[model samples]
Target: MLSALRLGQIDRYLLGQLLAGLVASTGGLVALIWLTQSLRFIDLVVNRGLSLAVFLQLTGLLIPSFVAVILPITTYVVVQFTYQRLASDRELTVMRAAGLSAYALSRPAMMLALISVVTCFVLDVWVVPSASAAFREEQFRIRNRMAAFMLQDGVFTQVSDDMTVYVRRRDSDGTLHGVMIDDARQKNAHATILARRGRFLPSTDAPRVLLLDGTRQEIDHQTGRLNILTFAQNVIELSSNKSTAQRFRDATEMSLGELLHPDPAVVTARDRPKFVVEAHRRLTAPLTAASFAMVALVAVLRGAFQRHGGLLRPFIAVLVVVGLLAVGLMIANLAARVPALIPLIWVHAIAPGMVCAWMLFVPELRLGRLSSLIPGAAA
Candidate 1:
């Protein structure tokens, strides 16, 4: 009962520490992301001809995606820092004297970890996917508007392969006079055609191009034959860089529920290992929050606080947690790619530090204590 009570109190303290740590950490991270993304926006606006409105809007929408990538790392860092502060202040020692085992103190960290897991799952499953879909949808919309840039007057417009067309003038009625076509690759090597006037027709489903009017002339260079072709109007295709469509997506966009319930046509044929691994990743990411919390707890119990530079050990603990999390993530990703060891992906994410949490629960592993479970700890 005493041990349970002691654990409960430490858990409360840890909770207090966690709340403060989360606000300071996530706030700073979000601000850093905004500043960096804004610089990228300026570059796109000045150099890539992106509109300020679109750039800013895209920047705002991109925050969720960034958060999805950085949230685990952020949680891990904060947890480590918070625990290290307690250790530095000798609060950990006080809690231990009150019959609290490291394991008991770890309850709060584990609770926080559990929360992290649920939060990460929601992000990967819902928030990130929706934001990504919106980002892609708006990108297509932006490209369509940008395609108008190709409508330059008095230039040879090559909209696609096998179509080269030139227009001398564009009338207000959307008519082009003195149309010249060098469509040699389209059919029988038609070298050039001169028209009195021409009109543009954009495909409703496809890209837009030009249609010639008046008279058309054709020549076969192989036979040195000049063929006079006359028509009321002729069709020519021009290429435009505007896309108003979305490409087919692979499995990365899917959530755990969707992946498990995938269509036979989508999931059957040739199985994709990346997607299978990603599904497992989604399942395991939530566990990472708890695992990160444990690591932080251990670091906190072992850390010391300096009277003058109080936050340094805590700060270093945060960095260490972040670094270890990054390494674990990288290992999991690489394991997912290897077909022979794909099943190891889950292990990579969750197994690395299982023993770290044990130190908190068992007193023997802690400093100046041995066999606390034995009748009289000293032999």
Candidate 2:
């Protein structure tokens, strides 16, 4: 039992090393994507004369979303790398000779996989959904206030070609009194309008504008004729702006509870397959950590080599893992088109489990003694 404990410790230590490397690499990749996406929004703010505060706040909110997306693949990668490295070294050979087998080494992986799956489940079902929604809503708020904030660079900003919007100044008072509108659209047509004060309200899908109360001077471009008129209140449309758009599907952003109990309307006829795929993928993400743990062991922890090709075994193991992932993705895509193929997710999740099981049962892969129970027990 003491010897068994020692073997388990060694296995765990090796696994930890692999897990660290995998998560780091995956996390780095995710961070890079996040930065790229953030830069896009940052550019938008810069062109619009918006401040840096909103920019940082918006990008910071996107981090958790990236974490959910990258965790699963990274978990698998680390395990595969860890196990193969042990196998390539005669360390595995020594352990096996001391009566440890593939199953023994994989025990650590199976246990860790369960932990990883749970983490993923919590991230997908809870953290990510809430963050995404909050981020989206905040964006809506920012766009709504975009015009108001435009008063930052100067007391006023000319948001439109013919309109000059001005604020006497900003203080706790929230007062905006703007004057001047130049209408020069048609040939030789021009108008200068003034207002006592104005209020800005954002339209859902058009130019952010303000309502003005004052007088107007109109000139007919055709004849250069001038006419003066007065008005109580007139709405002037500002420059058109677009809301932030992204490619992420609803499934990618929903919380676990939401996935399980999506609004019936949300699960509409056109997008059912996508939701199904996403829901199942979330539940199964954790399972793969365990499965990969085993497979990584099989690929890397098997075979007692005399020369110990340190990196070769790991590289080969990673290749196997990558191939399996590719197959899994292909199958998942096919399944999406045909839900009957939904079994593919299970297949991908379980393939590694089966491979690890095989390694546990086979003895030739490792130079090790058979346990006392083997049918052809060595005397």
Best by TM-score: 2
Instruction: Please list the C-alpha lDDT of all candidates, in the order they appear.
Output: 0.63, 0.65
lDDT of 1 at 136: 65
TM match of model 2 to true structure: 0.69
lDDT of 2 at 193: 70
Per-residue lDDT of model 1, residues 142-198, tens digit only: 544432234447888663455566778888887777777666554665557777876
Model 2 C-alpha lDDT per residue in residues 1-379, reported as the tens digit of each score: 5665566577668667756776687779888988898877875487666668868778878887677666666766766655556656666677767765566656656656666778777877778777778787776656545655566424456544444556554455544555555544433445677777665664563344444568878876667778878888787655332332332336766765566566676667556676777777777666776776666666565665546455665666678767876887787677678988887798788777776677666564454445522422332
TM-score list, all predictions? 0.66, 0.69
Candidate 2 residue spans exceeding 4 A from truth: 15-23, 44-56, 84-89, 150-210, 213-230, 235-249, 255-264, 310-316, 362-379
TM for candidate 1 is 0.66
lDDT of candidate 2 at residue 265, scale 0 to 100: 64
